[model samples]
Target: MKNVAVVVQDGAEPFGLGSICEVWAEPYHPDDDNPVFEFVVCTAEPGRIEGGSGFDLFVEHGLEALETADLVCIVPKLDFRHNDPRAVAAVRQAADRGAIVSAHCTGAWVLGDAGLLDGRECTTHWRHADELAATFPKARVNPDVLYMFDGNILTGAGAAGGIDASLHLMRRTFGARAAATTARRMVVPPHRDGGQAQFVRTPMGQTEADTLAPLLAWVSERLDEPMPVERLAAEAHMSPRTFARRFRDETGTTPLQWLTGQRLALAEELLENSSLSVEQIASRVGFGNAATLRHHFAASRGTTPQAYRKTFTCLEEQSA
Candidate 1:
C-alpha cells in the first residue's frame, strides 16, 4: 500500500484534516479487505491543533512521519498570514524526494511560499486567487475551477473542494473505480471536472433568496435580448440600486458578474453537450458575439471557450 502523509500546523481547519482521514486513512469497505493506502495525519506536535470555528483536533504522529510518505498533504489553517517555513520545507523536501505533495484550499499558499508553484499550474479558494497570484507571480493561478492537478502537485478551493482534490489523488493512484468508491463513502462526487467554474452571482429565480434565478431563467429564455440590470431589477420588483445591493448580499458578487457566469456556463454546456459554433453559443448565452464571449470566458473561466469545449466535450451519450 502506498503511504500518505497529511501535514498539519497549529491552526489547521478540521474539515480539510478530517477529509484526509475520511478518504485516505479509513478502510475502503468492510467486505472488500483489500486496502489501498496506509495513511498518516501528522503535525508538528502530534497533539491538539485548533481549527477554524473553534474546533480542536488531536493526532498522534509528528513531522518525522513525512519522510517515508508516498504522498504529503497540507491542509488549510485558520490564519493565512503565517505558514511556517519549517512546515513548508518539510512538504517541499518530501516532494523533492519523489513523494507527491498535495495541498488543499489555502494550503496552496504554503506550497507557493515553499516556491514549488513557480511556473506550475495551481489553484486555491476563489477569494485568495488575487493574493496568491500577486504573491507568486510565477505561479499560474486558475481561479475558475474546482481543482488543478499538475503532475503530483495538486490544489483545491475552500469548502469541500478539499474532497475533490483528495478524490483526484485517489483516482490517479488507484484508478477511477477506487476514487468513485471513496467518494461514495464520503458522499461526494468523485470526479467533478476541474474546469467547472466557481459559484456565480445571479438573481437566481429560486425562492431561496436566489433573486437572480428567476431573472436568469427568464434571460436564458430570451437570449437574443439584452439582460440589462434595469430590466432584471424590474423583473425582481425592486429599484435598480436596491436590487443590485440585494443581489450582491445574496450572491457575494454583482449582478453583471453573475450574468457573465451564467453565460459562461451556458457556453460550456453548448460546447460540451451540443454542436454549437462559438458565435452561435455566444448569441445563445447572451454575449451575442464570439469576441465578447471569448473575453468574458477567459476572464471568468481562465481559459477560452474553444479550449474548454475541446477538452471537456463528451464524445458519446451517457446512461442517464
Candidate 2:
C-alpha cells in the first residue's frame, strides 16, 4: 500500500481528486510517523486535464504510472458515463495484477466501463447508484453503504464517504492506531458506523430538531446494556412503530441491525487495541456471549474474532 496512483481525466471532480490526494499524497513528517505514499495523479494523456468545476489541471504521467502501484484509485468525474478506453484498460490490468482498485462516487462508472464490476457487490453515490446498476446489470449495487470492498475492488458512496473508504484501507493495511492518527490529522472520524442512507434527501424534509443524532449518541455510550426497540423508543419519546420508521429513514437500517453493526465496530476496535478476552469484549459490546459475537463477526467480516485480532496485531507490529 505504499505506492498509489490516482486516475483522473477530463471533467474531473475537484473535491474527489483533492480528497484522494489528501489521504495518499502526504509527505513524511517526523511527528506523525505515518508511512508515506508514492502518490501520482495520472491521466490517460499527459497535459491539460479539464475539470468539472471550470478549472483545468496539468498532469504529467500517463496510464503507465499505474504499472507499479499497489493501489489504484479512480477519481469521480462529471461525465462519468464516458471514459477513455486506455484508462479503463489500465485500471482492469492493475486489478488483474492484484493491486487494490478503488472508485470514489461516480468513479464506479469507470470500473463498470472496464467490466470490473461484474458479479461484484459495489456502490457509489446514491444519486448515481441506480444508473450504475442499470448500466451494469451484472453488478450487485448496494446503494446504502458508505463504502464496500469485494475482493480487491473498493467502492465508496458520495462525498465524505471517500474519506471513510480511505481510512478503512489504511486501517486494514496498517492498524487501528495508524488509521486513527491519519483521521485525527484530517480532522474526520476514524470510523463512521452508519451508511450513506443517512445523507440521502427525502420528501419528508427532516430538520435538526427531527434528527435522531442525539439519541444515537446516547445509545452508543450504553451499548453494553440491552436495548430493545421498545426501550429505545421510550428513550426517544416515541412509540415503537414510529421509532422504527424514523430509524430506518435516518440510518437506512433497522434498530437491531444498526445495533449489530455498531457492536461489530466496537468489537473490531477492542480486538485491535485491547488485551481482553473475546468473551469479555462480547459482553462489553452487548452481544452477551462469545458464541453470539463469533456468529455475527463471521457473518459480517467472514472471519472469526480471534483470527481478526491476530491479523490486526500482526499488521500493527509490522507497521511499527
Candidate 3:
C-alpha cells in the first residue's frame, strides 16, 4: 500500500497511534529495499484532538484524507461506547472502496458502527471482546488471537497487539523482507506465536518464585537438545505427570507446546540474522532436518523456511 491514513478522534490512545506510525510512517530504511508509505493522521473533527493521556494533538487533516488512502487504520480511543458518526462513516467509505480497514483495540467499535463488522470474523482487545460481540451480533469475535484478518479488514487486540497486526499487514503487502526490516528497526520480533490467551490468564502463581522459572530458562538454553517430557521432568526434579501439571500451572501451556514455540522463535532469529541453510537451522533448533523444519515452520508461521529466509535475510549479508 502506498498511502496510509490513521483515523484519530478525541481520546485517542497515544500508544495505538504511535504503533501505526512506527510501522507505516517511518521513512526509508538504510539497509534494505522497503516501501515508503505516505502516512497521515486524519480526524473527523479536525484541529485539536484530545488524547487518552489528557494531551491535545493538533491533527491537520480531515476525514477527506482517508478517501485516497490505500489503508485506513483506526487508532484506539478511550471509550468504545461513544463514536462519532462522521468518523464511522469515513471508516465505512474506506472499507467499501477496498482499502484495508484495520482497528487497534476498541477501534473495532468504530468498524462495528460502520456496519463493516457484520458477518466478518474479527477480534478486539480481550477485555472488550465480549462487548464488541454483544453489540455487533453478526461479527464473529475470536478473543484469543493477537489479531484477525478477514478480507481486507483487520483487527488487533490491545496495546502491543497493534504492533503485531501492523507488522502482519506489512508482511502481507510488502513481503517478509520489508516487514522484517521494519521490525528490526523497531527492535520487536517480526512474528509472535500464541495469542492474548497467554496474557488474559492470571500469572501462573502469585509470586514469580512460585513458578518453574529456572526450569524454563534451562530448557530455553538447551533447545537444540532432545527434550522429552521425561527429561524436562527430571530437570525439574518432579515426576513426569507432576512436571506436566506444574508446567501448565506455571506457563499456561504444555511442555511440548512451549518447547516448540521456543524452537520456532530461535529458528526465526536464525532465518533473519544468519546465513544458515534450512537444514542447518533445523538442526540447530532441534527440528532435526529441513523437511521437518519446513513442516513445523509452515504450520506455525504460514510460510516455508526457505521462503521466510529469502524474504528476511539481512541486506548487508546479501551484499557481502
Candidate 4:
C-alpha cells in the first residue's frame, strides 16, 4: 500500500492514468492522515510514449520501478489487443511476487495476455466484456459489475469505474474513514458496491423534475425508521408499483437494494467513527439486531464487524 506504480504503455488513455494518480498520488488531504503512496509512473520502454488523446507523455521510470511496488496499476491502452512482452512480464512478475496488480478497462486484456486473469474473476467495459471472456475463457468476466476484486488482482470497467476500483483498494488498505476523506476530496462517493451494475437504461428525455433524488436523500436520512416499499412509495407520493418501477429506472436498482446499500454505508461510517457497539450500530442503521448486521456485513464486505473494527479502528484511540 505504500508503494504504487502505474504502468503506462503507448496509446494509454489519459483519464485512466489520471484516475490512478488522483487516488494514489494526490499530494494534499484535508484530514492530513491519508496514506502517502510512493507513486511512480513507469513504462516498459522509457522516453516519449504516445497517448490515446493524440498527445505524448514523457515516462522516466522503466519496468524496474515495479519491482518494489506494493501495488501495480495498469491503465487502459488504445491498442490493448497487443502488449509489449516486457510490460506483460513486469506485470506478471509483480503479481507473482505478491504485489497487488489491478487493471482499468481494457487493461484487463494485458492481464489476460500475462495469464494472470486465468481462474480469476474479472471485469472490463461492457463493450469489451464479450471479447475479454472469449479471449480469456478461464477468466470469469462479469460484465454487469463496476469492478471485481478477486484475490490480489482487481479489475475495473470503463471511465469512472477506475475511480471506484481505486477507492476500494484505498478502503481495504487504509480504512473507511481514510477512504471517505479521499472521496470527499474528490467529491465522489467513497464506496460504490462493486456489485452495482455498470449500465442503466434511463428513459429517454427524462427531466430533472422526475428524478428520485429527493426521495433518496429523504430515505438516507431516515435509515433507522421502518422503510417498507409501501411507506416509501407513499412518501414519494406514488403508488407502490409505480414507485418500484421508477426506482429501478432512476437508480438502476430496486428500492430495497438501494436502501440496503445506504444502510450498509451508514453502518460503515459508524464502525469507523463511533464507539457504538455492534448491537447499537445495527439498531442505529435499522438492521435491528447484531446477528442480522453481521450477516449482511460479512456478505457484502467479506469481513465480520468485529474483525473490521479490529483492523480499521483509529490507532490514536487504541493507543490512548
Candidate 5:
C-alpha cells in the first residue's frame, strides 16, 4: 500500500477534490482484501477547509501529513500564482524527500509556483495556460492533454481531466487491467488519447452558432471533396464575391484558411491514433500525398507524424 497525501487549500473546488477522493478514498480487494492506499487529506490547518461549495471541508491532518507520504498529491487551487508561501513550501519539502509529486488541474500552477515544474512537462486549466507558458518557458507546457507524467512529477489538465490523470497513475502503478477495472467500476472511459483538444474545443467549426458554423462544418465533413470558393458561396446561399466578404467577416480569415485548419486537425488525429501510413492519412485529410502531409505536420508541430506517435502513444501496441 502507498502512503498518499492530498494537499488542499482554501476555495478548492469539489469536483477536483471529489474525483481524487472517489478513487483513493477506498480500497479494492483483489482477494476480497482491504484498501490499497493509506490515503491522507491535509490542509494548512486542522478543522474545516472552506471549499468552492457552500459546505466547509474538514480535514483533520495538517502539512505534517506529507512528512511520511510515499506519494504527495496537490489539489489544484483557484489562483496559484498568488497562493501562500507556506503552501508552496510544503510542496517543495515533499518533493525534496523524494516523494512522487502529483498535481491536479490548476494544482499544477502551485507546483509551478513552487519551482518544481521547471524543466518538466506539465498542463493546467486552459484559462491560466497562457500565463503558465509565459512565466516558465523552461517547462514544456502541454495545454492539450488531460495530464502528463514526466518522471515522478505528474500534472493534470483541467478539473475533469483529474479522472484521466488518476487513472494514468493507476495504470503505471498496478498495470492496465487494474486501471481498466477501476475505470469500469467508476463508469469512465478506460483511456482518452490525443489531447484536451477532444475535450476543450467543440470541433473545428460551430460556425452555425454565428454566421460561419454551417459553412465550416460542411467543408470539414467533406475533406476529400473539392471546396471551391464558388461552391462554398453556393452553400452559404450567397454570390461568390459576397460570400468571400462574409466568410472573412465571420471567421476573420478566408474560407481556405479555415479549411486548412480542419484538414490539419484530421491529419494529426490520424497520425496519433492510427497506424495508417502518411499517404493514407494525407488522402483522408484532403492532402494529395505524403509530401504535403509531412510538410504541414512538420511546419505546424515541429516534428514528423511518426515521431509524434512514438512520443505520445499511450495504448498497447497491436499485435500482428
Candidate 6:
C-alpha cells in the first residue's frame, strides 16, 4: 500500500526484481496521480548480490527493511529450491502480522520454505509447478492461473505475470483508476484476470486477417447482446465447431467462460465509475438481470454487487 520491500537474494533474476521496482517504485507524476510508494530493495544480507545473469548489485538495506513494510515481495531467484532461513523467517513474520506478502515465479519457493504455502492455493511458472507441488505436498498448487491470492499471500506465475500481479494489487489498494494510470505509464494492460491461463495451447494468430482479436473487440463492444456459439461463429466466418476449437486454442478458455469474465469485469468498472443501478449494470453487461449479476458475482467474486460497489465506489469518490 505505502511501503514496499522487495526481497532480493543472490542469483536473483533481474527482470523479476525490475518488474517489482517498476510497479511500486515509480516516481510521482502530477498528471498520473497514482500512489507513490516508499520502495526499498532489501536483502537478507545486504551487500553485493549476484544476479541470475553475470551482472551484480550492491544492495544497502537488510531484512530490517521489511519490519515496517506494508507489502513484502519476494523476487524470483535462480537458487529458488534453496531458501535462506533468515529471508524465509522475515517473510513469514511479515505475513503473520497481516502484511500483504507476494512472490513472483520461482519466488513461491521462499513462501513454501516459510511454510506459508501449506493448505493454501498457489502457483508458479508452469515449468516449475510440478516441482513446487512435489516439494511441498501440502500446498494446493494450481499451475494454470496467472496469479492467485490465498488470504494475504499472493503468488504470480512467471516473468510477465509479475506485472499482472502488481497491477492487480494496485487496483485492489488504490482503485481501478490508479491502477490504469500506473499501467498506462508502464505500457502494460491495466488488468488481466488472475484466473487467466498461463499459456494457450497454440500461439496467438498474428495478422489482422488471421487473428481473432477483431472478433473479440467486436464482442467486447456488444457484450449486452446475446452471443451464442452459432452467432459468434457466424460473425467470425467459421463453423461453430471450428470457432470453438480456435477460441480455446487462442484464449485458453471456452467462449462462454471468456464472455462471463468480460461481463463481470465490465460490471466492476460500472460499479466503480458509473452511477447506474444494479439492474442497469446487469443489463448492460449481458447478465440479463440483477439476480443473474448477483449470482455470478457471488460465484466469481465471493461478494455481492452492492458490497463491491460500496467498497470501490468509495475509493473512486475519494479519488475524485
Reference-based TM-score of each model: 0.66, 0.65, 0.64, 0.63, 0.67, 0.63
TM-score of 3: 0.64
Give the alpha carbon lDDT tens digit for every residue of 214-243 in model 5.
Answer: 667677789977788999988889999999
- Could you give the candidate ranking by lDDT, starting with the highest? 2, 6, 3, 4, 1, 5
Cα lDDT tens digits for candidate 2, 12-105: 9999998888888989877788889999999988999999998999999999989999999999998889999999999999999999999979
Give the alpha-carbon lDDT of every model.
0.78, 0.87, 0.86, 0.85, 0.77, 0.86
- Per-residue C-alpha lDDT of model 6 across residues 131-150, encoded as one tens digit per residue: 99999999999877788889
Which pairs of residues have clashing backbones in candidate 2?
none
Candidate 1 regions with alpha-carbon error over 4 angstroms: 28-34, 193-196, 202-320
Cα deviation of 109, candidate 4, in Å: 0.6
Greater TM-score among 3 and 4 belongs to: 3
Candidate achieving higher TM-score, 1 or 4: 1
Highest lDDT scorer: 2
Ranked by TM-score from best down, the candidates are: 5, 1, 2, 3, 6, 4
At residue 167, candidate 1 shows an lDDT of 82
Which regions of candidate 4 are displaced past 4 Å? 193-320
Off by over 4 Å in 6: 193-320
Give Cα distance to truth, residue 265, candidate 3, Å.
24
Residue pairs whose backbone atoms clash in candidate 6: none
TM-score of 4: 0.63
- For model 1, residues 1-320, the per-residue Cα lDDT tens digits are 38988888878887788887887788646653335677888887778877776777788998878899988989888787588778888888888887888886788988998889999999888778889999999999987777888967889877688888888777877788778778777687777643536343233233234646666567667765788899889999999999999988877888787677667766776777887789998888888899999898777666777777766666563222
How many backbone clashes can be found in candidate 1? 10
Please report the candidate that would top TM-score against the real structure.
Answer: 5
- List residue ranges in candidate 3 displaced over 4 A: 203-320
Q: Compute the lDDT for candidate 5.
A: 0.77
Q: Superpose all Cα atoms of candidate 2 onto the true structure and report the RMSD in Å to 1 decimal.
A: 11.0
